[model samples]
Target: MAMRRFGVAIVLSVILMAAFAAGLSAAKRGISVGEWLSVPFSDASFAKRWGYGETNGARNVISADRAQQRNGKPTLRLDTNSGFDCWVYFPNTKDWDIDLSKAKVMRGYLRSENKNGWGGDPWIIFVDMAGRKARFDGLKQRLYDAINDWTEIVVPVGADLDAKCAEYGWKAQISPGFDWKHISCVQIHQDTDGSGYTMWYSGFEFIDYAGRTIKWWLSSINKPDLSVTYAEQVPQYKRYIASEPDPNYNIPELVGSAATEKHWPNEGEQIKYLVHIKNAGFARSKPTDFVCMIDGKVVKKASLPALAPHQVTTIVVNWKWKQGPYQFAASVDTKNKLDEITKKNNTLRFKTDAYVLVAVCEKSIVAPIEQVNNWYGSFCFEDWMRGATIDQLNSLFKRCKYDFAPNGAEVSVRLGKIFLVDELPDDGAKIGEIDKGLGLYIFDGVWHYPLRAIHEWCDLANDFDWALNHELSHQLGIIDDYQYDMGPDSNLVNHKAYDRGPGGIMGGGQVGDNVYPAYADVDIAGFNLTKGHRRGFFGEYLYCIPYKNTLVLSIDGRPLADKDIEIYQKSMYTGKIEAPPVFTGKTDAEGRFPLANRPVPKDFTTATGCTLHANPWGYPDVVGRNGLFLIRTQVDGKWYYGFIDIGRFVCEYARGHKDNAVYSVKLMPE
Candidate 1:
């Protein structure tokens, strides 16, 4: 009998091992087999001792002594009946302990003499770790229907449809997430099977990436362990295959956020805060709570609406605390209610310098200056901040992890008030016909702006709100982008790239509904002439703002002291020359005055009637809006005017005036 068995083993090995080399070639590419497949089950006493000898009929009886071996090698074999059911469990379930945390798939092989009843029920591989347990199921119905003699089986972790198990079977529901670490127990079992069959299963193991090795003992030889390769190419798994999907669709993440300015000089200044919220998910995120804490104390809270997949929203908050070092921490969905991929990123802690904001609202021109400062607008200041509503101007300083505009520089300004006055704060009184155009001035560290004058420029404002942003940029040390000939010898021109890419605030005096400096290729369009992007340069001087030019005054070769002087815009839309003072000042004891808002956008009277020009010409030699300008002032207790050419004087100033004597002008009798 032993001689005949050996001869039969040699013959069967040739037939069974025909495809062994093919499987080995695939194994070389990265594949593995389960160690349980090779573990001996050939001990006759072992199979009978374990109840494998049970039988209902001649053909449906278990292998009593050991079936024919292929090449004298042993394997687990079963001669099952049409209604057979059994399982081989380890010393309790812990004997199946193995770390599969990094594994990508669980694979094995199944072959049967009678394919009809072999896989009626799925071959279940149940795993458990710690107290958590989950089953890798679902393909039993599919496996029962498989026709091939050598069937490759694969069960991907985390991503597979769960089948409705029986009373003691696993519930059909989504697995929270795979606990691949410390897999303490596993069961290789079959339930409710059928029909006379002889089956064999061998070389199974958990595998990670493609090109991994199977720790199965038989891998020492060239025998192919094709479980991993077969798992991928098998058509039955095609529909169930996925890129390991997480049951939790999204993770509401709160990246770290901080104040636009980390340090400030004063204590009674508002500290800006930005809380970044993003949806790290494949689907839209539900409404979540955003919380702010200062030194472990809840300072602010806001409800963030649903965010699209990968969408981001920045919550701007302005809080005031005693000037000192305060740890600022913000978190999203702190209640731990949402099922996220990870909870680590739900909170972000930032150390910042917390201070209070000392801001006041002063309005004029019968305009509610309080409303302008308190009421919120679009962009940064959209609503009340912190415990109480703060100044609208104060909200612009909040910085977020993301820059709304790619090129928009993060400019952090000093904590200050948003002064709202009707007429440039103490303009004394409105003189003659006032033009709509307005200018911003800095005096004694206070920003002074005209109130009622904003209505006049309602027609000239490139954007209704762009003026504020443009001026704020200036205060942050940004230069004007307009191309202007400072003089005949010096024509200042800036980068053309920034000049056109994105329409920006500093680019032009444009005002009204507009976006930030997000450049795109398009023609400037506007409902009103001043509504769209203005053609101007960008970043001419990043850290430097247009400085106020100085004018030295003299009358008939003598110093003109305490003389009332104002810069006017004589260029009108009618292409005609007209005189209208836009800025006012007084000559100091040294007969000098600081001038700003030069070449103002004013209407002028030309031969073609009244054509509005962007800047004041004031001279025929410069071909500007006005033929000449009058520097009206009181000289020797009499009204005397200095006829000036705007462009010519600017050119002269650039070419000749390099010292404190910026523009030496002799007031002549007009």
Candidate 2:
């Protein structure tokens, strides 16, 4: 949002701060109304009462002879000889009469016009009854520069007024004995020696004033609303999770007992974590199962079947041991068994190492080629070839090693039809034939074609090398100076000097000397892809199954064909029980490992629900469903499956090597 500027007025009571009992009493009295005097400048009768000065260049001249209409409103034309040097006064003012010591805020409306005014020149002043004056220099006033319409000018009489006056040479004029009483007069003036000037003024007022005190406050129309709002009102499927494991076991230790430093065990590892989940569906969600895994192996899992509609939940998970470089993931299952909705409801992937460490990196960039084409298509080339010979044309092509049929294949030149020729030979072709082949004409030895032909021909890699480099230069908004005769029968050999000296390409005839396109630093930056720093995978393999509710792991989307997935099961809240039934099976040709009903202890109620984990060598770990009444496994350690709340199913793929596998899983409400 752009910043907006606003003006405010504040009123303060000096009597209350004076430390006098009587002063406090005076402050409680509030503001008092002053007299309103009308100074008529329109009626002919009032004009006659005051003697009028010179009708042409007098200051504050009241004329009854020249009144007119402006913008359908009655207006008085006040012409002044000197800039802002106009004032009106009472007929007889020999002594001060009105009191001003109890006045505060003053504001007014003004309109002015200058035939040759540069905008910031001085033009007005205000004077009090004591001969004290406040000068308003247009250059010093902070008025809006874009103000071509009528506007109100406000002047506060409190601390700001005193401060601004001192800073701009107005304080010295109001020193000791400066009596502000009887100062109910206004004046408008201008630079003494400027050109002719005219101005319009009207609508004046004084607001929020109590003797000498002023109060500042914002206008009722300019207040803003402050309220809380959601970052995104609509639900989404994205989820984010952060985790850390104890140093002793590491992230890799959660895969299985046989897990090496590079491939840790899935059981007995501890991890700490948090998860943020967003649901994109409109329907309210019920309790669901959640699971976490490291390197295609399940380390932790949980289940919650009561997530509300469009609600976001953050959950914390703690593991028992340290794990190294692994990916932490979570998901929600609408069904207790492996199915599509379960797979779509929950999932977030992140590198364990990235969470534990911070690093600086760069973004990617690309080039702009369209800008260069428009610049070169504005010139005519026909006149330059008006008197060229066939030999000269062939020689020019030979000099550039321009192959017309190097691969025994004829180049397709669309210019033949436009030039009214049937065909042209590859070499030793007549000048007219050459022109026809190029979709252009060669009168004598110079060749000429429509600008579109250059655009079409330049797109071809073999012939466009130099043409495009030259045309692209023009596209950069640069002008071309290559001269060509617009008239017929011009000499083909006689060329104009382009003045683009030395290695110049387009402008100068030395096209081959500098045949590369010119680019700014921004252009160069677009091609800098090396900044991303690619890393190589170390013995890592990926297994992905697109079907929902099915736990099938594969390498590059290919099932591990006959390879077994190992399964592990335990309580997420407390690790005090023996492993459940061992479920291991090999995958089909599609790399899918399917596991049906496994065993869940009948003795453990909701107080002792269990999670299932699966893992395959070289691939990451996978977690089955959580809060399960039964556990299942397939393809050995490669795939794991389980159910939550007895009906909701969930699964996960483990990631990370053995040495640094850390997994922290959280059980969140739907």
Candidate 1, residue 582: how far the Cα is off, in Å: 99
**Candidate 2 structure quality by residue, lDDT tens digits, 536-584:** 1110111121112334444434445665544443222231112543356
Q: For each candidate, what is the lDDT?
A: 0.36, 0.29
Q: What's the lDDT for residue 91 in model 1?
A: 20
| Index of the highest-lDDT prediction | 1
Candidate 1 per-residue C-alpha lDDT over 447-469 given as tens digits, one digit per residue, 9 for 90 to 100: 33445443222111111244544
- Each prediction's RMSD to truth: 30.5, 36.9
